[model samples]
Target: MATDPVCKMNVEPAKAAAKVDYNGQLYYFCSESCHKAFTEAPQKYAGAAPPPHSSHQHGHR
Candidate 1:
């Protein structure tokens, strides 16, 4: 899964609705809107680090 730089949504690379190559890296998007938004002003929405994982864990009986 790839993180959409614009919306931070998890995107499946093989099934991504849109994708773009910026600065020699490929970015995936969940929708066309996100793709357009990214392409328009990449600097505004690029290089967003993926959301961090939760440190807490739940135990079930």
Candidate 2:
């Protein structure tokens, strides 16, 4: 499963209706809206490295 950059929801790549590839990596989105969100401000989510996350410790992007 992949994560929605906008809502941070777990999303299955096969179930995703939209996606974007950046920096040679693929990002799966739950919907077009999330895809657009990630596409528009990729820098916000991409420029920095995200820390590891857990259910009790959600990581920052």
Candidate 3:
């Protein structure tokens, strides 16, 4: 399984919607949107740290 850099979604390499090779590393995307986003700015996400997981509650009534 690979994490989609753009949205941090878990994706299966074989079943990925799209894949791209960047800087000698292969990246997989859950959707074309993510693929497009990553290709547009690979550097922005390639070296970016994954967003920390949090359980903050959303405001709801």
Candidate 4:
């Protein structure tokens, strides 16, 4: 599982609605809206550190 940087939701990479690569790292999003927002200005959501990359972490629904 991965953390959706824009909305902070737990998402499975294999089941993610969207995915983006930034600075050699992979990011997952729960919805297209969040993906769009992140693409428009990733810095706004990513902040100082990128979300942790995980395979099966739990997150808010």
Candidate 5:
């Protein structure tokens, strides 16, 4: 699973229908709105480092 950068929601990497590539990193989103928001200014949202243990245990940004 991966965290949706726009809303900090849990997104299954294999199931996400919305995703964007920013600076060579992949960001998954829960909805089109979230995806568009990130698309507008990817650098602003793309730089966000997930919370501690986010790669496993999820948390807010």
Candidate 6:
């Protein structure tokens, strides 16, 4: 399972809605919206460390 960098949803690479190769790493997305968002600003999500638990909620809101 791979985490969709845009939405943080778990996705099976084989069943991913879209996938992209960036900086030698592969990223999977659950939907085209996510894929488009990532493509537009990969540096915003790519290689970005997951937020700490305490601040995680802030992102969702």
Report the lDDT tens digits of candidate 5 across residue range 1-61.
Answer: 8999888899998888698777667889888998999999887787677445555644445
Worst 10 residues of 1 by lDDT: 50-59
Residue-level lDDT of model 6, residues 1-61, one tens digit each, is 9999999999999999999999878999999999999999999998585435647667776
Deviating ranges (above 4 Å) for candidate 4: 48-61
TM per candidate: 0.75, 0.69, 0.78, 0.75, 0.73, 0.78
Candidate 3 lDDT = 0.87
Residue 56 of model 3, lDDT score: 43
Write candidate 1's Cα lDDT for 1-61 as tens digits. 9988998999999999999988767999999999999999997776455224322333433
Between candidates 5 and 6, the one scoring higher on lDDT is: 6
> Which regions of candidate 2 deviate over 4 angstroms?
48-61
Per-residue lDDT of candidate 3, residues 32-58 (tens digit)? 999999999999988786334422445
TM-score winner, 3 or 5:
3
Report the error of model 1 at residue 34, Å. 0.2
TM-score of 2: 0.69
Q: List the residue pairs that clash in candidate 2.
A: none
- Pick the winner on lDDT between candidates 2 and 6: 6
Could you tell me the lDDT of residue 52 within candidate 6?
Answer: 56
Q: Report the candidate with higher TM-score, 2 versus 6.
A: 6
Each model's Cα RMSD: 7.9, 6.7, 8.3, 9.0, 7.1, 7.1
| Poorest stretch of ten by lDDT in candidate 6 | 47-56
Candidate 1: segments with Cα more than 4 A from true spot: 50-61
lDDT per model vs. reference: 0.84, 0.77, 0.87, 0.85, 0.81, 0.90
Q: Write the per-residue lDDT of candidate 4 for residues 1-61, one digit (tens) a residue.
A: 8889987889999999999988777889999999999999988877745456542466644
